[model samples]
Target chain A: MRAPIQRYRNILDFALSSLLRRKGRNLALICVYTLVIFVIASLIFFVQALKREARELLIQAPDMVVQRMVAGRHDPIPTIQAEAIRAIRGVEAVQPRLWGYYYDPVFGGNLTVMAASDQELAVDSVWVGRGVARSMRVNEGDLISLRGYGGQPILFAVQKILPEASELVSSDLVLMSEKDVRALFNFPEGLATDLAVTAGNPRELATIAAKIVELFPDTRPIMKTEILRTYEAIFDWRGGLMVVVLGSAILAFIIFAWDKATGLSAEERKEIGILKSIGWESSDVLLLKFWEGAVVSLTAFLSGVLLAYVHVFFFSASLFEHALKGWSVLFPRYRLVPALDAYQLTVLFFLTVLPYTAATLVPIWRAATVDPDAAMRS
Target chain B: MASSPMRKSTLCLSLIGVQAALFLVMLLHANAQKDRAIHQRLSSGILVRRLGLTDLCLFTEARYTRHPAMADRHAAFQDHPMGLDHFPSGSLLAPPTFPSPHARTHPAVPEHP
Candidate 1:
């Protein structure tokens, strides 16, 4: 065992020297290989992190959101529907949600106005999101006025600015009292945007959602699971689209690796022959070449993954952030919580490291098996 | 031959060291971002009540409300029909007492406000 270990160490040393001998070519190969891995790893990390963030935040969301559809368009749900939903079996609570979009001409953007139940606001006061506060140049206690449905400017004191930390969800959010929202949007007295339904038993969520549709044919019950699946599909589709876009480059790299592996340079062939002639067994020659491939690939893999982590988590995935985050005028700048999937890393390793290492083996074997004098002459 | 192996091993070790250093830098950056997020959450007011930091929340709110610019704006908007009249004079930071239209009618429905 000690002899074998010592022999492998010598092979590794020789492999390193051999690689250093062709510094320019190997360096170029390592650079390109590392770049390819970096792009793929960054995409995977960005998508997974966004997905994890969505899942974490959505866990606290209501089990089912019941909305009324009129002529295939979302319509305000009547408050009376809440009573019926409340009486349904397995339904824990049914709360009517008041929320709407307010188009601000000044900024040429829409602000999401929602009723806040936790903290009360005076009739003339409202809470603005961090983005809104910044864009409007308004701070706490400042009076910001908005044009209501009646064309009258409704003045509201800025009671508090929603935290910038929650900006991902609240960037364009405005929390106002129900009366303020109703007055601003001119929403009718007994109508709500939708109903947030909670289930007493987690298992009964599906049953309650189905019953909701049955009870109200025109109503749609959107379950949290469906929303999660929708988000997953969206990210997967975008990630797939990017992969397709980078497919040609990836193919080029693979071809380059294949060509290099099969057509070992004359210098490398002579080196192998010299080793074989000097009492080095074919196995030892093969192991030396294997180490060369393994060292280059493993180093590239580690460096690529590290660079990708910094790119996605630290730099906010600049190249793909805009596309994945969707379009908004006042987009919230928030650091995504870094989340890694071991399965994804494993798949990446197999996809990149395995094929390149395997490609080297065939040419190494061909060179190792030949007669030393014939190989050297060639 | 001895020197060649020694030099090669040193080179390989240096390469690995560079990668490890980059990884450490990323870890530190991630930690910084996490700390920033925590600070933002603390100051954002949303978590104040939940975290039992209402005193800090109120103090911050009071400071903002008492600023000269805010006081001036409050006084200027007094003449507007839907303005400072709705706010009780001394209770500028008071919680709303007016029930929303839905809460006014359907008392059974859970009110979020």
Candidate 2:
């Protein structure tokens, strides 16, 4: 038992010496490997985190939304539609939601203005998102003015600023009373932007959606699952696009790794041959190669992942943020929540560490199994 | 330099050990973020539900890119690509979200073709 453990330790020691013998070349290989891993890892982390944020925001979303269409364009559904949907069997509750976009001429950005449902805000009071407040240059006590229909100026006091932590969804959001929204948009009293419907059972969402559509032919019922699936598909495909775009870079890195591993320096070959000539078995040499690959690849992988984590969660993935996360001007600046899932790390390992090790092994095996005299002579 | 065997071994071991320690720090950071996210979501959920929040305000270059589910199928194509030209995210976000099956076909059951 002691002999086997000591033998492996000695091999590990020899591997370290061989690696340091050509420190510059090995260091360059490691740096390139680490960079490739870093870029790929950062993209994966940002996309996954953005997906997670979307999913989290949608958790509180209604089971289904009912909107009316006219001439293939979205139109405000009659508030009376909620009463009609409420009578549907198995429907828990239906709410007529009032929400729309308001273009602020002073700021050149659109703000999402919606009426609070469960809680009633003072008709003249509004809750402003951090983005909205910053853009409008208004504070909690300050007043924000908007031009309504036919150039009717509507002014309201800012009651509160939306929390920054929730900026992912709420940025550019403006929450007001139902009456205020109706007045600001000159919306008819009987009309609403859409209907938020909840079902007693999540499984029954489809049945209820179908019933709503059947009751109102012109009405479009959008299930929450469809919304979730849409987001998942979008994010997954976006990540795929990045991967495809980076495919060439990854291929280049793989080729470089293969060449580096295949071309063992004459000095390295002579050292291995000399070791074999002096009572060292082929297995011992092979084990040393394995250790060398493991150390280099593991170091690169660890540093790459660590740097990516910092880049994404801490620094907001500045390198790839534009491609991955982009809204318009005054968009929310929110840091992604960090998560290092085991599955993600495993996939990354396959992407980075495994390829390098596998590339090294074949070449090293060929060199190790050859005649000591031949390897030294060559 | 591959100077002393003991020194080289220590260097190797310490290099790996320091990397592992840094990784552990990152793991802790992720866990902390997760915990904070859960807390924020709790309060944020209540507010969003009360206000009946719709799609996330992720994009704002155009109406189609802003609300994909509600966007008309032809809206993005109608104006050409200029609407989302400033950002590459438009193309990526365009494919899945733009076509509103809800308004047209409304396929109740997912059909695998």
Candidate 3:
């Protein structure tokens, strides 16, 4: 064991010296390698962070959302449907949700107006999201007038501004009392935009959904699990799309790696020849080359991933932020929660480092096995 | 001459150390931020919607089926027909007809055959 360890150390020393000898070429190679990994790693981190955020927030979503459909369009659900759904077995609670979008021409964006649950706001008061308050330039106690469904301007004093951290889901949200929502939207009484249902047993969610559909055919039931799956698929597709867009660059890098591996320069050939002639076995030569490849690839991987971490979590992934996050004049600037999956990291390692290392093996073996005299002559 | 190799080795070692330290610090910071973000989100009552990159594809594919205006408005809703027979007599009260906020020029209720 001691002998093998010593031998491996010697090979690594030689590999390091050889790498240093070609400082200019190796430095350039490392730079390109690191850049490629940085881009890929940043993309992975950004997408995974977004997915994690979605999953965490989705846990709080109602177990099932029931909406009424009429003539192939979502229509307001009758509040009585909530009573019928509450009677369904396995249902723990049912709440009629009053919510709709109010297009604010001033901001050129839609503000989500929802009735505050369990809180009664004064008829003339409203709670606004941080984004809404900033765009509207309204502070607490300031009244902002918005057009109701009747096209009449209604004014409400700002009660509170939601915290900035919660902007991921509530960037354009406005919360008012049920009375205000009905009066503002001219929404009829005894009707709700939708019904949010909670199941007593998570395992009974599917059963409850089916029962709701049976009771109300026009009702559409959206389960929390379904919403999660939709989000996962959506993110996965976007990530896949990015990979496809970067596919050419990745392929170019791979070709460059392959060329460098298989096409040994005259100086490298002479070095191999000298090692083989000096009683160095083919295996030793192979190990020496392996160490060189390992050092370069491992360094590149670490540097790239580290840079990606800073770019995404610290810098908010500025490069891809506009492309991934939707375009909004009043885009809410929120920090992404940094989360790393061990599985994703492992996948990246295999995809980026392993292939290059493996590619070097064939050429290294071929060069190592050559007759020492013939290699020197060439 | 001998000192040159020593200098090179020291430089390489320091580079590796610096990179490793940077990685460790960033990773620790990320984990801490992740925990705080998760705690904040769980306590805050907010529903997940198409907001970020997911929206790019979701909005393009006509796949915003989860939107309030489009939820269950597709073929899935047509698959399960709930005849009037399913409703218990007097269980569902007739809601007063009111103009829908979105129904501008069209009739509030489409005429059913």
Candidate 4:
């Protein structure tokens, strides 16, 4: 074992020296490989961060959601449901919510608005995202009049403005008082658009959800954890796309590797012949090739990771808006708050980098199996 | 033992053909997947409409308005001058007309079937 390790070390040293001598070609290969990996990694980072950002915003916002369904339309649930939801076993609090657009017939487009059922409870207050506040040009205590459904003029006094939470999903919320919500549109009592529920044990969430459904068959219980499930589905779809891209990258790398290893130049053939003539085994040649592949692939992966960080956190993941944002009219231009913990890095390394590097071994193994004299003659 | 460049060219062409075939397969799969996605979206939209799920966001109601003049006119038209021989050409409820091309020259009479 010691002898093999020492021999491998010698091979690696030789490979490193050879690469150093041919810096221009080696560097070009490294750059191309790095770029391909970099784009893939950046996409991954942006996608994960986007999901996290949305979930984080949602986490603080609701535990369970209740929306009214009448004739398949989501009408505001009567305020009475808020009282009934408070009696559920795991529920800690129930907040009735209202959301609508305030159109100014004089102005062309609608202004987004949201409100709560009770002002003092702060249950349905304007959750002003950073972007909405900036765009609406209004502050807390400013009275804004908006045209409701069918041109009914509704006015809301901004009681509070929500501080910016997550740029992913928080940039679009507006909260208001229940009285203001009713006065705005004159929707009757016992009606709410949705009820936000907070349960005690996060583990018993499913049981609690079942209970709620049993109690109110008409309401849809939107659990907060369901976002994670949705993201998993989304990620699975993305993973399929990545499999194709990464698979192609690996195939190309393999072809290049096989061509380089099998079709040796005259100088290389002469050198190998001389080495074999001087008692170097075929295994030694294989080791050298393996080391070369390792060096190139590792260098590419490391550089790609670093470049992905810059692309996501520093440049704000600009290359990935279409997939992550879908067709949202307003997208917040914000840098990803990357969670660069050891676990994430370890996962990424194993998941993306290792698969590509391992693909190089098939060609290396083929080259290694060749008879030295036959290889040299070829 | 030098292999002819033509032989090498043929090998390269074969590899290219293999890669092209693989890529074509991937493209077709992707397109099929995309078509499925569009189909799903359309079906989901229809489901939402059928279920009235979209009604939450976009329900609008239309109510009929009661106007006394229109009601009176309709009632009078339906009654058909039963006790009287001729229909009144002018009524107090009719808006005063200045000289106009649209005004009736005489009272309208009901035609017997």
Best by TM-score: 2
Looking at chain B only, the TM-scores across the models are 0.29, 0.53, 0.36, 0.28
Where model 4 places Cα greater than 4 Å from the true spot, the runs are A1-28, A50-61, A88-92, A101-112, A116-127, A134-147, A151-166, A179-189, A200-212, A235-270, A278-283, A341-344, A347-373, B1-113
What is every candidate's C-alpha DockQ against the true complex, given to 2 decimals? 0.08, 0.24, 0.12, 0.01
> Best-fitting candidate, measured by lDDT?
2
Clashes of each: 2, 0, 0, 24
CA lDDT of A337 in candidate 3? 83
Where in model 1 is the C-alpha error above 4 Å?
A1-10, A150-152, B1-6, B17-113
Alpha-carbon deviation at A236 in model 4, angstroms: 4.5
What TM-score does model 1 score on chain A?
Answer: 0.91
**Highest DockQ against the true fold, candidate:** 2
**Mind listing the fnat for each candidate?**
0.15, 0.50, 0.22, 0.00
Q: Show what share of the native A-B interface contacts model 3 retains.
A: 0.22
Question: What tens digits encode model 1's per-residue C-alpha lDDT throughout B13-54?
Answer: 688888878766766665566666556544443432221111
Q: Point out where model 3 deviates above 4 Å.
A: A1-17, A20-24, A118-120, A278-280, B1-5, B45-113
Which candidate, 2 or 4, would have the higher TM-score against the true structure?
A: 2
Given the true complex, what DockQ would model 1 score?
0.08
Residue A148, candidate 1: C-alpha displacement in angstroms: 2.8
Tens-place lDDT per residue, model 4, A15-37, is 77766777887787778777777
